[model samples]
Target: MKRLIATGLALAALAVPARAEEIKELNFGFISTESSANLAKSFEPLIKDMEKAIGIPVKPFFVGDYAGVIEGMRFKKVDIAWYGNKSAMEAVDRAGGEVFVKTAKPDGSSGYYSLIVTHVDRNDINDLKDVLDCAKGYNFGNGDPNSTSGFLVPSYYVFALNNVDPTKCYKRVVASNHEGNLLAVANKQIDFATNNTENVSRLQATRPAEAAKIKEVWRSPLIAGDPIVWRKDLPSDLKAKIYTFFMTYGRNGTPEEIAHAREVLAKTSDGWGPFLASSDAQLIPVRQLELFKAKVKAENDDKLSADEKAAKVKEINAKLADLDDQQKKLPSM
Candidate 1:
């Protein structure tokens, strides 16, 4: 009887499954929206705070492009990350990622705008139309392919809606981050470039002289604030810890501690305050925008057969309708 009891206990233990490996550390991947040095300086305080709150070592991962961060999360090398909506969508779709929270502006607003900026001294280029006049032979600096405000917004509103392909419309086209594009235009390194209000405001605060050199020619409609994502498979306890840390970091603490946390967050990006609880549903509008862009492209493709164009547009419309339904089901933010 004793032997049988021991055998049953062993079988039960096996059926229960071995415990998951403990998480010793977390690697937070940061997208290259600015120089590595600047990003490091801006985020160090937050990283340290996160380490203390989570009781684990936290490391910052920097890469040259947005896709690097997405790939990092996909491979489980990056446990968490900050991502713009478009890239966050990519991560959610392809990187085993899930949105947990999003940054909120200091003013309590939840969105920012995309911008087209040119040198203040350039009188010739005054609007989207001026920039789109391909005959003028202007050089352009676009944003990272994965950037929401930088690439996707302007690509849809400024280019696609006008039936212009940026690659063929400009004398030269260069792709870089928001800061890079802003500086390029300011210095006349490029005639115009894509940027966002957040980066512009950041520059104004950090480098007023540089900020004064560029002026906006176009501004897109407001886009949702950036989201913080984590690998979906992270241990539930670890996810809870991280969620608590972000939700409370700046909202609860000693007076001075809260002040310090707010200050650190303000310096990071777009002068944000405490994070707000969010989910992958925040990406619905962005997904709709993507589909709309695809629909427009299909409509404009002269090479497509009439039947092919109809089929493409039909497929895109179906996807957009599904997304609209999903958005309707979500509670109003």
Candidate 2:
């Protein structure tokens, strides 16, 4: 009887599941939209607020480029991140990331625009036509490859649609973040560069002298707001805490608290407000942009044989059509 009772107890213990380890810290990654010092200063208040709300150490992860943050999330070194629509799409597809919220404009605008900018002193280069003229041997500054406004939008609208490859369209081509590109243009380091309206507005507010030296040469259509993403496999309880904190951060609390939260948010790079509930679906428009860009590239490629190019174009068209259908079904934001 004693042996049987011991056997039963052992079996019961074997049947019980082990408790999962509790998360001790959260690492939030930020894309290198600007200098590290500037980004740290802008996000400090929000970071402190998040740490207090989540009851854990919240560390800020920064790198030289957007890809680094996506990779950090892929390896589970970063638990959350702020990603432009283009980078967020990459994170969702490559990393274990899912968009949980998105920044909202203070005035309730739905999106922002990508811009082509030049130094105000450059009377010779007034618009997209002059930049694309390619006879002046003008140097160009592009945005980070993964940036939506900085790279993708302008790449599609300015270069791709015009069938001019940026590498060959200028005397020199370089890649940098929005801030770097903006400052470069203002300082006349590069004749022109890709930037977005948000960054330009921020610079205008902070450094009017610099902003005054820059002029918009061209602007792309509206692009979706940036997204805040987290690892999909994060602990359910932790996810809940994070979700609650973000959804309520600036939108909730007393009048004083709300004002403070709004001020902190306004200091950030893009000067956005309380986050809105978002999901992977928020990336649909960006995905469509990507597909359209790909389609244009496929159509423009000169090396491919007639049949090969035709087949590739057909495939891209199919993808674009699918995206269009998906977009039609989603509720309006």
Candidate 3:
């Protein structure tokens, strides 16, 4: 029977007609970008539900970080995965992945913020400049280099602009995932860190004491939501079923059904309330940020002669401009 895993957990009475040769099993990759065990636990109920809805045995493929997940998709070890925009770009470029949809916040917004945070009791670290002033003495908790908000945003907006090399400035700098960073900051293991709004919100709800101990010092602009990526060459029918599993979840269902779906989603600390169909274009904004950072670095290269630097910066700026124009052409999510 075709059943949409919508809200309140009511199953559809009829099933989507099966194709001539349907996939009986699939490997769904989950990036332990945060806490692998915790993230996997949160998805357990939904994974089972998805398996039942799609009438296939969906295997959970958990990996250490974005790179592993991307490489897994590249090597065909993963059929589908959830990816941040930057890694999603990698998946598309190197892994033959295509974005079919993205997860949305409970308010239906398709974005979240990347924040600079510190211990609530650290009155001396009240703001960005303070963090920099204390940089030489403080132990820093930085995001993984591959992370978009964790690494890319802070690198582009904070360290690069200020001409500060974190590795040199901080007493000790530890690269950790969002969950690790958050916990480190909360326990005073690290003096400062970067975390996303989604995880922060979930922490506030699920771990109030830890959340209360952490405070946002600064935050980046809205980052496009995470995408559900799949191998581009997967058979169309299988792709359809996979798409249906997410897109149909929490939609077009009775109140009880809707509530049930919401309940299941609640377990995922990211406050994901729905899945919205999206395209690869959703990544253009972040890609533009990445390009802008490259331009910044190229312009500041001391090894290059003035003329050479100017020429390189000009080339990068042109690409940024093209992406900017392309971004404007896409519908606002």
- For model 2 the local lDDT of residue 208 reads 95
Of 1 and 2, the candidate ranking higher by lDDT? 1
**What's the CA error at residue 328 for candidate 3, in Å?**
3.2
lDDT of 2: 0.86
* Cα lDDT tens digits for candidate 1, 209-239: 9999999999999898899998877776677
List runs of model 2 lying over 4 Å from the truth: 1-19
TM-score of each: 0.93, 0.92, 0.90
| lDDT (10s digit) by residue, model 2, range 244-299 | 78877777789999898889888877687877777789898888878888888888
- Candidate 3 regions exceeding 4 Å error are 1-22
Cα RMSD for candidate 3?
Answer: 5.0
Per-residue C-alpha lDDT of model 3 across residues 36-112, encoded as one tens digit per residue: 77877788888898888878898888877779888999998898988888888889989999887888876777888
C-alpha displacement of 275 in model 2, angstroms?
Answer: 1.1
User: Which pairs clash inside model 2?
Assistant: none
> Over the full model, what C-alpha lDDT does candidate 3 score relative to the true structure?
0.80
